[model samples]
Each structure stands twice: as C-alpha cells, then as structure tokens.
Target: MRLDKFLKVSRLIKRRTLAKEVSDAGRVTINGRVAKPSSEVKVGDILEIGFGAKMLRAEILELKETVKAEEAKNLYRIVE
Candidate 1:
C-alpha cells in the first residue's frame, strides 16, 4: 500500500489528501528516512508522522485496500 493510502485507510490521518500533503512536506518518515506519498508501505515497516506540536509513530501490522472505522485500529500498532 502507498503511504498516503495506508494513512487514510488506517485512520491515522483524517483524509488521503491531507496524508499526501503531510508526506510531501517531509512530515512523514519511514524507517527514519523522510517519506513521500508514494512510498511503499508493508507489514512491519515503521512510520513516523509529524503533526503540529506532536509526533506519532506506528508499526504497520497489516495492509488492506479498505477497512471499516472500527477495524482501522487493527491495521497498525502504536510505537513509543
């Protein structure tokens, strides 16, 4: 899955466009390197997203084309 799509499908970001913008602006990273919207996302990959005044890090647990809101949380696991 693409970084932007995963972010949206996983409910980490509110929308796909927002996720793309965030990724393009270097606010998103994969494995400690800056990432783009088109970056590939796979199981076990580490993702770090920067939001104003805060940062979110998560590990991809699964990749799905679509997921319900209630099940979105199952797609990734938070990392400290």
Candidate 2:
C-alpha cells in the first residue's frame, strides 16, 4: 500500500491528503529515512510521523486496502 493510503486506512492520520502533505514536507519517515506519499508500505516496516510537538512511531503489522474502525488498530503496532 502507498504510505499515505496506509496511514489513512490504518487511522494513523485523519486524511490521506494531510498524510501526503506532511510526508512530502519531510515529516514522515520509514526506517529512519524521509518517506514520500507514494512510498510503498510493507509488513514489519517502521514508520515515524512528526506532528507538531508530538511524534508517533509504529510498526506495520498488516497492509489492507480497507479496514473497519474496529479493525484499524490491528494494522500497526505502536512503538515508544
């Protein structure tokens, strides 16, 4: 899945556009490197997102085109 779509589908970011914008602005990183909106997302990949004063890090658990709200949390694992 695309990074932006993965972010939205996984409920990490609220919207795909916002995710793309932030990613393009260099706020999103994959394996500690800046990632683009079109970056490919795969299982076990580490993702880090910078949001103002907050930073979110997660490990991709699964990649699905669509997911229910209840199942969204199953897509990734949070990492401190």
Candidate 3:
C-alpha cells in the first residue's frame, strides 16, 4: 500500500492528505531513510513519524485497502 493510504487506513494521521503532506515535508521515514508520500509500505517495514516535538515509531504488521476503525490498530504495532 502507499504510505499515505496506509497511514490513513491505519488511523495514524487521520487523513490521507495530512499524511501525504507530512511525508512530503520529510517528517516521515521508512526503515530510517526519508520517505515520500508515494512510498510503498509493506509488512515488517519500520516507520518513524515526527509530530512536532514528539516522535512515533511503528512496524507494519499487515496491509489492507480498508479496515474498520476498531481494527485499524491491528495494521501496525508500536515500537520504541
């Protein structure tokens, strides 16, 4: 899945556009390297997102085109 779509579907950023903007600004990384909004996201990939002064890291656990709000959290697992 596309990074932006994955972020939204996983409820990480709430919206696809916002996720795209964040990724475009270089505030997101995949496997420790800067990633673009159109970057491909696959299972087991590590994603680090910067939100203001805070940072969130997660490992992709699965990929889906759409998921219920209650199940979104299953798409990724938080990492330290």
TM-scores of all predicted structures: 0.97, 0.97, 0.98
Off by over 4 Å in 2: none
What is the lDDT of every predicted structure here?
0.95, 0.96, 0.97
Q: Which of the two, 1 or 3, has more lDDT? A: 3
**Candidate 3 TM-score over all chains jointly:** 0.98
**Pick by TM-score: 2 or 3, better one:** 3
Over 4-73, each residue of candidate 2 has an lDDT whose tens digit, in order, gives 9999999999899999999999999999999999999899999999999899999999999999999999
| Among all candidates shown, the one with the greatest lDDT | 3
Q: Candidate 1 on 1-80: residue-level lDDT in tens?
A: 89999999999999999999999999999999999999998999999999998999999999999989999999999999
Candidate 1 weakest ten by summed lDDT: 48-57
Residue-wise lDDT of candidate 3 within 1-80, one digit each (tens)? 89999999999999999999999999999999999999999999999999999999999999999999999999999998
Each candidate's root-mean-square deviation in Å?
0.5, 0.6, 0.4
Cand. 3 Cα-lDDT: 0.97
Top-scoring candidate (TM-score)? 3
Error of 3 at 36 (Å): 0.4
